[model samples]
Target chain A: MLRIILYSQWKWSRGWLLPVAVVGFAIPYFMLRVGYSGERYWDAAGLLEQVAAWGRGYPALAAAIGLLVGTSAWIHDHRGDHVYALVLPTPRWYYVLLRYTAGLVLLAPAMITVFLGALTATWFTTLPAGIYAYPIQLAARFMLATLLAYSLFFAIASGTQRAAGAVLTIVGIVVVTQLLAGIAGSDLNVLEAAFDRITIWPGPLEVFVGRWMLVDL
Target chain B: MPTMKLMLAIAFLLALPWRAMSGQAQDLAHVIDSLRERVSFWDSAAGYYDSITRADVDTVRVGGFAVITNGADLAAVEDAVNELRDRFIPIVGPDTILFQDKYFAVLGRGSHVVTEDIILAGLITDNITSQLHDAAQWYFGSETGRQFQSWLGPRVPITDSIAELPGIYEVIVLSPLTVVQRCHSGDIDACGASLALGLHQTPEEALRAWFNAADRRFLVGQLRPQWDYDLGRRADQTDGERRCIESESDADCVRILAGLYRSGMDVEAYAPGTNFHPSLPLDFATHSSLAAVALELGGDGAYSRLITSNALEPEARLEHAARASIDSVLRTWHAWVLRAAPPSVEVQPRSAWVTLFWVVVTAFLAAGSSRWR
Candidate 1:
């Protein structure tokens, strides 16, 4: 059953996986090129500025890949009304676990490709003294971020379209509330407040708010 | 070989002043250029701006004035400074640099690079000060670190540590995080004042001060709740260490105190001068303790604001909101803090081989004497 689930996930994502993995592989190389000017005397500050600017791509890439893979995991099942999985002889929880782990296993290629690319980029680059590259840390962070995004989108995919629509309506109301509050010149900033709630320490999204430095002090 | 040595001696002789001047400091212009180009303001904790405050600006101002005064081109520098002071100060907003570009247009004079640097130095400090002020207002209004500004909205200033300086750059290469750790452990003048009070402080005294300040900041910052058991433990440890000081060897006392200090036990047996803090200087063994008095009155930030005031005013408590106000405070702070501006421009680089030669010759004679004996 595990083999069957794994094969199914692979078949679903095979086309998207290779292309996105290549993009992930290219990110660190591009970041390195952008950061390190071909000068013997490079300004660490200036180089860091470029590197940091490029760092925005890491999470976005993770989210994009996570969304693609996660949605793909369930898209075929959703189209068939999940009847294919319902007929499986395994217990419900076991079948769900099989699907989930299978999806995670499929993401390994992309994660590994990104880590190796980042490592290769770090190997070739010369950072100023006192600054260092965190290839492994970055790779680990990327993995977690991708996992988080995948879990989130995958959970949303589990729900019916009406449930998704209700979530969308709640988000829209919040945005409208924030806009109206701003128009009224109230100190209320619910959007920023919500962002802070989600992105502060102990919050799941907190990890991404920190300086996304590939090479850092 | 004789002529070679003679020529070598001549070259080294001329290199002395050049070496000395190189060690003096990089020109203020380079620092300004770096500030304009690179620094993004990252305040470590709320209510505290970066460490480089009015004092650094004074050093740069005095240094810049010296360069201008001593240069053969004083008239040009003086004209630029005067133009900025009189005409530009009024219109100096966040967009003062833009105003500067416009000023150049009206006067039809080429841009004064030196004057522009001095102005940038002022702007950088102002930028830091305002961010601090905003942070303080936010924190004071709502005692939480949650309310952060959307943008850094300011240029960066040198923070808890100085920029990597030449000669001493190696000593100060620790990142801001490392400095903050040292500060949390009570090593760096966490309050941004220098530890250069010309008094010999032992490791024990330094550690003692660390424990005390950590305890103070923790208390004032309201880091731990009033009912925290750790506070009691820290106080007891301080007492035990103080009692142990009398019975044990000073070395042993330091060992005991060090443990207690690390454990964060505040010393009940502590007296005013029991162990002097690293940066806080008292009027005496018994009178006017700066750190204690300030905390008793307010919090660590207030006390810090008193001495360093990364955001607070020294004399006037001036609001550095607009460019005009920022420029005003910049002018006022310099006048009040420093002595008359010195003519301390970089000295002409001369050779240093003569000193090197003499030292070598002396070493040679000393070695020969060992054989002669």
Candidate 2:
């Protein structure tokens, strides 16, 4: 059952997933090419800045992949009003479990490609003293961050149309309240407060914060 | 042979410019013409200088600050001065005695001219307060007539945050000195050694007090370029310096450093681009953080206490001001420093576990979807 679900998910997301994985595989190489220029002596500070600039793309790529794969996991069922899922002998919870596991399985290609990409990139480049490439650490972080975003959007996408609408309505109300507060010259900012709560430490989004360096001291 | 070729190349480059000078003679004439042009330009600009001297300098006073400017934006300058006074009030106390008759002149944006007594900052800038704060440290320090340099460098106030503390943490962690690493690991004695508190030694004794033989050798290597420059300037390489660099003799390294100190190189070798005094181990931020912790523990009248206790040794003075044992104060500081360690590249275990918990929770939420009905 899990294998069938995995094959179905691959069929659905393969086109978009292939391109994203390819980009992920190419990114670390691109970072090395752009960061170092075969100078006899490397300025660690300047190299650090370049690596940091390239590192920002990982989280953004992870988010994109998560969004694509997570949505694709439920898109067919959602389009068919979940009739196929309803007709299956498996319980709805079991089906959801299968779909979630399937999505996670599909995430491996992108994760592995980036890991290999980082390894290849650092393999060719001679890093400065006290600096080392974190291919495995970077790959693990990418996988976890991808899973986080995937789970969040997956949960939302798995809901009924009305449930999704309720989520949107809540978001709309928050925006309206924030706008009203600003217009009335109040210091209240609901969006900013919500963002801080979501992005700060211990927040689910905190993983995306701070330097995601591939090569660091 | 390479050195000979390098010198020949330099000589050739220098001669290239003047090789045609005597033959053409037109080059010399052009140089004279350019110099004359520059003189005339300066002669014409003298009128502008005369106008500036003749123009009235406007004075803007706010709280304890008095700024003299060319009447461009007195209102903005007034606000900036008021803000600076607000910042300084916390660090220096409410007593306006130190601020009395201190005049600052603003000439243009981001420019500060410092005389013996007066700090003239030119124009309004985003960093006006920071620039003024830096200059005022010296002015205030001089007014207090206390030597606070034994432990802290300039005693600058530090505002700690995630973005700020990690840099200082990196310094302590990545330092070559074992004492600094131990300090980071919460060793109070190591913290004292690293901070060099209560050590009344000359700069050489101070360096020896903080660093061991291997540590001194490492420092010598790091400061090799500066030592080479100083040696080359005198055109004399001492036996100690020669042995230190060539034979990697640690004792020779220490001796050369002592000579450098006796010959006028002090804290300048350790911390360049800072107006620091001798015998301090850590950088400005790290010292400031410790001082800040002391001040916070001391609470009300802490700044006054700190200033008055300057006659005592650094650790005694800090303890006196904070009204706490040196051990407690240093332990607290060491804990704070540890907490500020740089964020890791790998995902933290807590973060990973928390993320997993959330994933499971969200997955369960997805399973309970009303669409399943």
Candidate 3:
């Protein structure tokens, strides 16, 4: 049953995942090529700055890949209104697990490519003294960040149309509140406050913040 | 006679056009000079306009200090000023006169006002409380008025909500200095040395006192821009500077560092935007955190004692104020700094477990979707 679900997920997402994987591989490699090119390799501070700029792409890529895979995991079921899923012999929770597991397994190709790219970039070059590479750590962070994003969007997408509508309605209310606050000359920014809560450390998006350097001191 | 007459006629004809061309050239030069003067006038006018606009800044006075800000940012500026007063008064005592009538600008968040003090901008703007907290440190230093250097870092409370200390924690953990390492490893005397509370010397002597030979040599490389600029300005490079960079000589490094001071070279001006202070060992936050520990130990009037102590050395002043041994004060400070250490880059086990828990919970939530039912 898991194998069948995995095959279906692969067929559905392979087109998108293939390009994502390629990009994932290219980002770290290109970062090293551009960041540490020629004389830059000797300039430690400048190299670190360049590496930091390149590092921004990882969390964004992770979030994007998560959304794409998560949405695809349930697009077929949502379109069919779950008629196909309802006929499976396994329990509903068990069937959902199969689908979730398959989607997670499918993320491996992207993760592996990023890891390999980082390894090739770091290990092949002699990093300046005091600066070190963290390929495993970067890959792990990317994986966790992806998982978090996937779970969030997956939970939302797997719900009924009414559930999706309710989520949209809540978002609309927040936007309206912000507009009212602005008109009323209130300094209270509900959206900014909410964003800070969600993005700061200990928040769900904590993994996306802070230094994401593949090579750092 | 006819040949002579013809030659004289040719000479007169050539001289006539030469006079006309010289006159035209003079007119063109006069026009260019006039245009240059107009450009200079406009340049000065632009500068005058900028100064006038800066002078027109709105001032909001609260708690013995004036907050200078552009009119647009007045509301936020007032909040920050009030925050500073509420937080600062307790540590420095209400009796101290703070910058009486002096203007201070709250610069970040697009607020531009001119003042003599350091501009609080960049990362500090992320949290207004911390921003004002830093401003209060500067103001308090001014209030204390050069009679005493407040080796006591930022005396204001680091806002409890922020996850990391704005800029200081990384230096504590990652600094290559032996004194900082020793302080981290529970050496009280080293903590005193690292904090520079004991040494009240010239900047060069303070640098020598704080960091050892290797660290000084290492710093020469780190502060390359300043060293390079200082050397570049001279007709010839100093032998010590050449030896310091090329041969990695510590003696040469020391000589060059001292020579910079003797030459009255303004290295900070040369290396713009670099916090390349030779005298200060640790950051202000680290110093303030230690002071906070002392004040906490000394109870009420600790700040008064700290401000009024006759002791020349800061460590003794701290002891006099805290009413405790310098060793005890330092030990407490070290512990506090370690406790306030920023979050590690490595993913913690607890975070990993929490992430897993969320994954499962969200998976269960998806499973319970109404469409399946």
Candidate with top DockQ is 2
Rate residue A7 of model 1 by lDDT: 95
Candidates 1 and 3 compared: the better one by lDDT is: 3
Better of 1 and 2 by TM-score: 2
DockQ of 3: 0.29
Cand. 1 Cα-lDDT: 0.45
Compared with the true structure, what per-residue lDDT tens digits does model 1 show for residues B263-345? 43242223222222212221111111212122222322332232223432211211222212323333332222222222111
Tens digit of lDDT per residue, candidate 2, span B138-256? 45444433456534554445222223555566556555466776777677888988877655467667677787766666555545233336535313455666677668887787776
| Ranked by TM-score, top first | 2, 3, 1
Q: Write the per-residue lDDT of candidate 1 for residues A41-107, one digit (tens) a residue.
A: 1245456667778888888888888788767877887788767866776554555556667878988
In terms of lDDT, which candidate is strongest? 2
Give the per-residue lDDT digits (tens) of candidate 3, residues B1-373.
9999999999989989999999999999999999999888666545543543567667677767775555435666677777766654565567656445655554435322223543332223446555655655554444333435535432333223123333344455456677777776787887788887666456567667777877776555554433246545423445665677668787778776666545553545434443334435565556666666776777666666776677767677778868999998888766666677544557766666667777788888888976677
Once fitted onto the true fold, the runs of candidate 1 whose alpha carbons sit more than 4 angstroms away are A39-42, B1-373
lDDT of 2: 0.72
Interface RMSD of each: 33.2, 4.4, 4.1
* Total backbone collisions, model 1: 18
RMSD of 3: 10.9
